[model samples]
Target chain A: MNLRIKLIPYERLKREDAKKLVKDLKEGTIILVDAKLDPKEEADLIEETMKVVSTKFSGIELSSMELSELKETTNFERFKNMVIERIMGKKRGLTIIGPAKIIRKIEKNPEELLLYM
Target chain B: MVVKHFRRLKNRLASAIRKVFKKKKEIKIGLYGPVNSGKTTLANRICVDWLGEELGKVTSIPHETREIQMKEKVTIKDNGRSLTFNLVDTPGIATKIDFEDFLKFGMKRKEAKERAKEATRGVIESIKWLDKMDMVLVVLDSTRSPINQVNITILGNLDARNIPLLIVSNKVDLKSSSTSRVRTAFPGYDVIGISAKTGAMVNELYKMVLKKI
Candidate 1:
């Protein structure tokens, strides 16, 4: 299976982006959300991403959780924009959303996620 | 009531015996890193220390070993600590694999595309086998910037799994090599500097592995 990973920023999470996201999920393209582009709190990221990915696509739920966390960061050189993530009391990393079937399969056995690669 | 207690005691005793025996099993120590980070070279260094032979081919070209390579039953003993493991040298991990990236090395378009495909698949296989590893050596080019996405992603995956890892800051023979930079980037992990090609500090790594394990 061909996997298309879309790295959409938080600012561009508009209606057209939502359409493209749902369309890609239907076709099994992996969506990676980098919230640093717009800088939001962790709760807000979950809310907005869930709103776009969950209700529109029936039977598909957004498995939004803290997959990664920034326990400590001494500087803000590499991730300049994402520094706001720390300021907003949120961590930084990609929020992955995908087709319900694919997400289900990965959750059932994360070992099987390699199959898409 | 005493009979029921005896049955439960028996089950716990059996489980304890299984755990003690299982710890003696050989660990799978995977060599994981970005492309051309000297994973194969380090694997060869350890293999030569015990087996008197090298592991795989090394080249300046990226993705040279686009598959999993293993040497089994390599045991290292130092100062009462010993680690017997299967040394797995895996192809490097990259966030993106493109045929155009390979073309820079002066390869034909067809071969480059084929190499790119195999390299991408190799990355997936490397990740799939991550769960099987008892330990991992995250090799890095010491001179380069340690804040790249590839390094962070690799570390994040390992951290998620709670896998034990040692960061190898290799190629220290070069003028620009800075093991301290890599250490600063990853504060807590054990970052060792070495010239894998020259076997410098390789023995120290073996002893360190036993300590870490």
Candidate 2:
């Protein structure tokens, strides 16, 4: 319910920073990131997060689909699962790119997001 | 001629059978949460899963739930009660967007601040109905870092009224989900994690509520 969603840049994060992020996040925090603003750094972030969070995370590709279409992919479904689990007070985590392009793509393909949150 | 008569007789019998069990008990269930926390999505999921009809709109933009939405006569059999649970979904509660943030994006400072003030007032108006509900389901988005003030305010007010609450961790199906922390943040309340989209833990949620209401 905290109106202020904490924005964290994946670029500024260290490999061992999960503990802190986890602490702030478990407290019901929202993070805002700009993935498309810096593709290289975002890619590095996704890569580094996977390394840290392990295989429980999956790779997702949106291509040119709108936001709606993006949600339908198996990967989006997985992300929604992670989000839902977190909300339930479960501790599983996932790594996702906060790309406006990706957001646009999913928006274009809203159907894909239909099955997931 | 004989076929017509038989069809008419069948239709009459069906109506008679339905009438015998027409009476239903209605229970009102309310879904409330902060902005962007998926209140409508949860409501849409319930409509799809239980009512077989999606009654509300879903949007990613915060404050999309600007008004109170109610879907009446939702029938659910719980414990020994034959109940009709009306699902009421409310808008997000956020202190309006700071005018300075918009001004920083290139708007006039005074104009931006005024707009921000108006937005803050809108948020208050949207959440004022918390006092009139039978139950409150606080929806929290799990992907973000947990913040204390807004939810604490919501929970504190609800607790003051002694309203039975069910904290729903929505979007739980997303990757990087940390629900345990969500549980810890809210010390004394019934919490449940669910994929509102996949309908994962909803049935279990029903079981929990069945005991309470």
Candidate 3:
């Protein structure tokens, strides 16, 4: 099986609906988002994934890591990052979404994410 | 700005009035978390502590509790202060439920498929029931990393809905369990470490629950 990984900007992701993401996932393509999705967006994605679960398409394995959450920073730096995230409408990080059938699990650590197939 | 302030005040006043007149019997405290996070164990502990019975069956398999189970009129007394409310044990939430995963646990192929299908529906029902909870206990396995999408999403949805919540870092009896890790993952929430299986520090959890409600 040919493995396909699609890199999607967070802006484009926000512009497009989660259905599009789920569609890519259904086709067995791994998706990499430029920014970590907020909790609501993640929840929305899970809901969308659940709607499309079938025998072939089980669901999605999603994991995200925020840059700000990785390292300890001063209060000022934290505030600055927050301001930037608010202005940009997404956190500075990386998110990986893949079909659960393909990727068995996404092990997450404080600093990194490991995808196991 | 004045209108905004007035609206805030009005909302506060209305909320206060509602709290004053609200019936205690209607209060629903929900147990929510990812799959295999020991939510059922916690529920059973709470039930046996207050109601002299267990709420549901617990197992090593994921998605064991595929439906919402509720026990009413559970009253907990702490320091001479008693509180009573309905306890709701919800099915564990997961982003995926592949039938093949269950086959590894010695389940038959047909039974695995059925369990997977029911598990998917259970996830949907759990999410749908979130809005009905007066308060939620987000149970997390302390032995596992707490930064997963399910944990983040659960915490986020609760925050979005303005629902009061407490993070229950369960399985403290395990050597790998670390409540500090859970705290580090989620810094601003109320976190309590407990061993639901062993009934360790559960009284502290009860006190925290009473304080939250």
Candidate 4:
């Protein structure tokens, strides 16, 4: 019953950012990441995060979404332009990371993604 | 690499081990887990499959099974061989059994208290009967977190006694279910997810059971 979520713009993700993420994950926080923020470096950061928490139980589930789909729902997110710019900038979806000990499972639905946001 | 090598060695030696346990015509397979995790449901599935009868009643209420239930001489048909077993369905184990918890479900306080005491005794008996188990199925709800201490303690005790075991992650029929989480939690153990109520992936479980023992 412990449902937790966090939204992070992966485009701005840094090595230090990854370190903090490792800490939050240990606390059982499910982090949602956007790859557009730092497209070139998110994967490496995730890899780094994996290595940091590798000895512990963990998992990741990713789901993709179109920026247009998100925009249609909220009538225009104040951050829609940023998301669109980022999607155009090559960020395509959301990546969820959490302690597998708690996160357990995930279901993908882009439309429902806003609720978590 | 070490785990891989150990598994290879274990597989190489499984037949020899099987020969020893196989001599006892009725291998005792214990069904154990926390309350409402579906141990009885799986037990019923196995019993019905081999004996044409359900093992016991299954309900949504916790600790409904306050005593050990048994079904004997269930012969399982594997690849080309038949294996018989005495399926032992035990009461759920809990660190704390509070009558108040049962009272929340609308049971009278007096009955709830009595049930709690019986459940606590059942837990003790289940632990004592561990020695009777030739092998055990640690059934768990796949939709829930696998970090509970009850199962961990049971697993540790089983490890100490060198009892062979397989984790049955039940209720994979739920949308929120994920065997992968159980897999990650017990990286070294074989964990299988199945919906015992619907009999999904049960054949896979049967094959794994044959391989495990």
Candidate 5:
């Protein structure tokens, strides 16, 4: 089986719609985004994924980790990190999206993400 | 000072108007969670407590409540205060559904495939029904880690829609159950640990629900 993994910057993912991402997933390509998608984006992606679910394309296995959520931070540091995230317009972390048929699960820990294929 | 006072008055008026309008509409409290997270069990507990019956079937299998099952006019009373709403028991949300998983439960191949198809549709229907809920109870298995994409998505969507939510850390009767873990996972949210099967801490849940809605 030919497997393709695509690394996409958060900016490009934000610019494009989720339908385009689902299309790539349908073609058996795994997606890796540089930044953790915010809740709304994650919800939107799930909605898009559900719309395309079929016998062949069951759905996606998605997991993300935000850098701010990784370690314990003081109020001041957390405020600073929040400011930085707002300035960057994205959370500092990583997101993995894979086709459910190929990827069994994406187990998430507070510090890291483990993908099982 | 004059502008601030005027703004305060306007805000008060808007809030009053909202309450008045809210009273005229039927409130819907939805059960939303991951597959096999004991949402239906909790639903049954809530229904049996107030309505004298169960809302849906509970099973070890995922997606047993594939359709949206609702119990209307479920009113819970606490300290002379009663809150009435339609309790919506939705299909558990899932990102993936594989028929092979069901085959392990000793189901026929055709039955498993059919269940898989219905489960996918159930997921879609659950997502579609999100907008209709006024409040939501997000049920999570206390034995499992709560920092997953599904939980995050469900919480995020509810937050985005400005819906009031309470996180339920279910299955606390199990030895591995840890409500503190669920609390620590989502620090800012309200998390209640309960055993729906044993009716443990369920009254507290009802009180919390009354307060939340």
Candidate 6:
């Protein structure tokens, strides 16, 4: 299953920096995230980010939220509770739900997240 | 002042005599092609040269000529018999694109894809009008990549209908133009490569059009 690692603070990253990260991420690479990114300030950034991301990951399946741009933002406790319910014993690719830096968590212990989610 | 006045009167008398003897058939020519084929530029050229000196605004954006445009004039060579003709410039045929939904402040991905598909369908609908045309001028942009599904569909339809097709490969002045490639793309098809910007081969185009008529 596809999981998104949404980068929060999208406005902080330059276009070139985003490109490099996206290139390195490779297609179908999973991001295991802990929280959702700020939506209002980074909405356009998400689209621009996705364009670059798609160039690298054409046809790759996408699942879950990296940043919740949904009409209603899911609270942190509720999000975690829902993720626990959805991911328990599920073997799926992980994605970060917040800022680009959130990727660091996945980089550190991807295998652990894989075992859990 | 008297001599000048007489000259004006004499010119008017000559025109009146010419009008009495003119005989020419009005030809309705339609400029058609896949989207981004530069039909508008060619249409504008014909309008300026044959219909009037003033050209309407020309744009490079696809589907700029979304509706049919008509221009008329009397062919001078054939006396005053008016060679009035209508030029139908239709919308470009393209893959689906949905801007309307995307422009909405908060739209869904499903909605956006639907919009693109709708835009594409509109193009196909516009192309169906080709059946009513007397002659078609197929414009092709020489700078773009090789022709794909869109060009194939247009050519196949025109061939099936037995419509006289004049393939115009426009924008030849561009350095990256693929005139020869365009010819190879549609083998055995009569293709004319012309720089619409410089008016090159426009006269040749007129002659070809005249012969077809």
Best model per lDDT: 3
What is the DockQ of the complex in model 3? 0.56
Q: Regarding DockQ, does 2 or 5 come out ahead? A: 5
Candidate 2 per-residue lDDT, tens place, B85-152, comes to: 78888767652243445555566867655545544444544456665566668888877644433465
Q: Which ten residues in a row have the lowest lDDT in candidate 4 chain A?
A: A36-45
lDDT of 5 at B122: 84
**Which of the numbered candidates is closest to the native, going by highest DockQ?**
5
Write down the worst ten-residue block by lDDT for model 5 chain A.
A69-78
Docking class of 6: incorrect
Whichever of 2 and 4 has more lDDT, that candidate is 4
Alpha-carbon runs more than 4 Å astray in model 3: B1-25
**Best to worst by lDDT, what's the order?**
3, 5, 4, 1, 2, 6
Candidate 5 lDDT, A6-109, residue by residue in tens: 99999999999999999999889999999989887887787788777766888899998887775775667767988999999999889999999889888887
Give lDDT tens digits, candidate 4, residues B1-213: 344356545644653675676685558889988788999999989888888999899888898998999988888887796667889999986544556678788999788877766776677667778877878899999998885445655665665456778899999999999999988766667789999999999888888888767
lDDT of 2 by residue, A1-117 (tens): 333356554354433254454343334443443222222222233233222221122212121112212334475565675576457433222222222211222221223221111
User: Model 5: residues >4 Å from true position, as ranges?
Assistant: A72-74, B1-21
Q: Global lDDT of each model?
A: 0.66, 0.54, 0.87, 0.69, 0.86, 0.51
Best by TM-score: 5
DockQ, per model, reads 0.05, 0.02, 0.56, 0.02, 0.58, 0.01
Judge candidate 1 at residue B28 and give its lDDT: 88
- lDDT score, candidate 2, position A69: 25
Residue lDDT tens for model 4, A31-61: 7776422322333333444343322433232
- Candidate 1 stretches with Cα past 4 Å from truth are A1-117, B1-21
Q: Which stretches of candidate 4 lie over 4 Å from their true place?
A: A1-117, B1-18
Worst 10 residues of 1 chain B by lDDT: B1-10
Model 5 residue B64 lDDT score = 92
